[model samples]
Target chain A: MNEQPVIRTQGLTRYFGAKPAVYDLNLEVPRGCVFAFLGRNGSGKTTTIRMLLGLLQPTRGEGSILGHDIRSLPPEARARIGYLTEEHQLYDWMRVKECGGFQSQFYPRWNEKIFRGVIGHFNLKPTARVKDLSRGERAGLCLGLTLAPEPELLVLDDPAMGLDPVAHRSLMESMVYLTRRSDRTIFFSSHQLADVERVADYIAILDRSVLRMCCSLETFRNSVQQVRLRFPGPPPPLPDIPGLLQAFRAEGELRLTCVHYGATTEKALRALAPAQMEMVPLSLEDAFISYLGERGEKSFILSETEAQP
Target chain B: MSFNITISTGLNMPIYKQITDQVWLAFVTGKLAVGDQLPTVRTLAEDLVVNPNTVARAYADLMRDGLIESRAGRGVFITRKRKVFTREEGWRRLEPLIDAAIGEAMTMDFTHQELREAFEKKLGQWKHVKGGN
Candidate 1:
């Protein structure tokens, strides 16, 4: 319920040599919320996460995590944060329990109870060697180590990748438990939109090295709507609706996609008074694609029918 | 009581509907009850890191469905008992999806017996689970 942001970035930008990887990224993640970082592959999600963790320096801009300047904070600040990369690399020679013991030494807030719970919940053998574990088991072990630290903020990059359904469920359950008990803030990136949709309170979509949209999951759902209309002859010219994000014309039908389409857009569409009009609800994937398509190309507008004389 | 909402990405279901359905299920099952305040639109949005509009849509749908109501000052609340689905209604709702899933399972080399056994096992597990009635 705290109003202050746990993570905030202002005009953040990062580049891979001459190429801009992330541009003008301005974001604020509230405390104690599960923030889902969403994007296609190579959309600067990993880069952004690296910047926030201070593992990579931003070419420009500034930010803070837990109110401490990200760039200036010492390892102590990061120690208070738990991170799990998409590729969980643990010492191959150590036992799962040994890994936990070694990792616990670095964090002052390590929670043995939570650690044991996660290990048991994942059905991970304490004596299993990291090298001998399956990919899913290793990932679970990484997650177990991360959760055991009990950091104030947990940043995960695709924790569910390569996990079977049961392991995935356990990971999610562990996340829910951690968030509920500690009010820890979780920021995770995933190509798996369903998992993002499952547990995230906030979602940010990135595409082509730019942030396409960022909002609460609820707002994202309500603002976008799919409208289908059929007009006599070729479709009628669409009006300039303030929130129209994309429009397309096909087979004498006009399809309009809009963001923040409420009573206002409905009124505008009614003014055209097409022969047939229907508002179809759009799924999050459809909406994300629509928005990303529009953002990718400035000329990309929703198809509308040609104007009648 | 605490409740968690999960959306499945592997399935073809929409995230908003997943949110809506799961939250509805939570309310109906008594895991979340009348007067239980759900997270604010922005809080949940940030948690999921999705557009606030998406979460808003689910909340709006829930409001329209009468499962949860928005109090002017307090926030959204679970307002009613869960609706019990009749066998016909349940079949009506699930048959098509189940058919599709089974079809896919068949293509993946699952025999009918295997699929039925898996489902029976899942149902038995659900029956034993606490707090999901």
Candidate 2:
């Protein structure tokens, strides 16, 4: 493992005019790990990626990519990074081969073999014009270009969007192959939690321009859990237990979502001694929903609660 | 050989079950053999951007099924030489999901033939890719 993080941000903030897009963000992406930047639509994920790639200037704070200061570094620093935006546009008139050839001129270390392999694997037709490719094929072409450059880091904004199952799986395999061989760091943003859960070693959940959670994938999984308890009538108030992050009630039942359910919260729940209690392990999607709810997003709710104990 | 696993969000099946099923398929098709090292839970989790616990749960399930084993100071590895899936067991494991998918397809105005054709096509593709012939 590389000792220095490939990407580091300290209080990184970006604003659109007066509206804050990303606020006081601090993150460390360890070298060679595929880090997932997760968020709902318009949750500062794109803004953060833009700032990190030097495509947009930050309003305040600092970030370093490959040890180069993002704000101070020229395009040369960005030249070492491969970034695929969500709305990636390709020239419609150019043949797939022409585009690949054109992109190769910008990077000195572009790998023709890998490019050919990926193109073949994705079954992309070099003779076909960019306009002729399907949405998923277009994304695969962009991925081919990105991977060919052999950059130290890859920043992908929803690479899986609009892809069929086979294409998505192929793209993911290419990413895995790249990371494993080159030890490249990948920072990808996606609304697809399942994809994120599949490829990312670390995760950062962003919501409403704020960093909701950031941790290693292991820690993130270990920390959160969904607990189910049925009450006779209205549920009692929850105890103010440390590590108990959030709680709410459902139909004659109380649900406690915890960050790290230790002995204290267990004892606290046991104190209630409901008719029946079950601890259901949560998936990443469930955890993401709970975290977002706690931040008052209002998209989903646990239920009406009596009060906090 | 390491295969990258991707799970579909819109699919009705649980993500862990998908992982387990894919890994088992890989093992059964000779794509992954005994002693082939599996990606670390963290690496696989990051690739999928899922919580590590979810992948760990899948790993634990695989271990329980005797498909993979964990080695101290190393990592998980494919253990089963060949998966033993009886017809009934396989159907029992997959029937509910297939039924749900078929129901969903029907609701989307897909004819029975269309649904069956799609399944056959996917099954053919899987065989072609995994057969390595």
Candidate 3:
């Protein structure tokens, strides 16, 4: 196992004219870990990824990928990292086999078996022209090309985007298979929380242009929790509790969404003298929604008739 | 041995815990027997479309519980030694579970006698299954 982090950045920032796309970002991705980069759309995920791979220049600060500086990563180092973007770019004029032949020339460690396996699993024919393949087929071909080199680090930007259910399952199977080896690392940005919960060991949440949290998946899930307190009538004013992300009322019960629901928070809630108190376990998707949603906003808006006592 | 072990991503429990629980259930239900070879971590992960580390963790937990053992160069296999808890250990594990059951029963308006009867019925059903096995 490599002791050093596969990727690292220090105050990496990017600006588009007057507006900052990504601001003062710091990240450290350890080797052999499937790191999920999660955020809302246009939350600087792409900008940050682009900067890390040296596709775009950072407005300030610097970063490294696999120990090579991002500003000047050499071709040899670049060949050891597989990058798959949302767009599965390939020459429309080339055949599937021709594409593989063209890609294999640049990498000395290309594995024909992996390429063929992924292609066959996706039911793609080598003779088929790139232009004739479906969207999912194109993604599979890109994935095959990416995995054929067996890169030590895989950086994917929404690999599941625009893929159908069947194609998404194939992508997941390929990723799970890759997890068999502990020497390789995958850093991906995705909106698919369910998939992230299953595969990711570590995660870094980017909110807007800033980094909100970076921790283990379990840690993050455990941190964000919902507590339900039932009152005899209407719930009393919520006590001032630290780490409270959101609080609202539903069915005359006060529901509190908190970052860390420890003993201190429990004691504070107990002081409210509710008739009953319960802790509700949240799925990863629910937790993510609560964590990112607007704080202290009512979950639903009731009309005049529905709002009657 | 072939058995179906399905997991729901929407559940609050972690994926590894779900895998371990299902494997144990398979053993108890006679779907898996002693010396039955379990799938490799990689194979199971692929089938389930989950991270291999989660499957590995499940295997590790099963091994720790004496329910399964890994042979050198071979895949994991079900072990003969089913964990038999001592009276104290059994109580320690079951106390909270019993408490929860009783609490729920009471909330649902079941009397003490009704709760005891339900418990005995469950025990009888379990015994019948074990006897057939």
Quick one: best DockQ, which candidate?
3
| Order of candidate numbers by TM-score, starting with the best | 3, 1, 2
**Lowest summed lDDT window (length 10), candidate 1 chain A:** A300-309
Q: Compute the lDDT for candidate 2.
A: 0.77
- Tens-place lDDT per residue, model 1, B1-133, is 4787755454435667779988867765567867888988767755664445557878988886677888888888877656556668777977767765775586479988999999999777656335324
Badly placed stretches (over 4 Å) of model 2 are A74-76, A230-234, A241-252, A294-309, B1-133
Question: After TM-score superposition, what is the CA distance of residue A162 in candidate 3 from its true location, in Å?
Answer: 1.1
Considering the two chains of model 3, state its CAPRI-style docking category: medium
Q: After superposition, how far is residue B125 of candidate 3 from its true place, in Å?
A: 1.4
Cα-lDDT of candidate 1: 0.76
Write down the TM-score of every candidate. 0.70, 0.69, 0.87
Candidate 2 docks with a DockQ of: 0.09
In candidate 2, how many Å is residue A249 off?
3.5
Looking at model 1, residue A290 earns an lDDT score of 73
Rank all candidate structures by their DockQ, best first, as comma-separated numbers: 3, 1, 2
Candidate 3: tens digits of C-alpha lDDT, residues B46-79? 8888888888889998998788999999989999
Give model 2's docking category. Answer: incorrect
RMSD of 1: 11.6
| DockQ per candidate, 2 decimals | 0.10, 0.09, 0.54
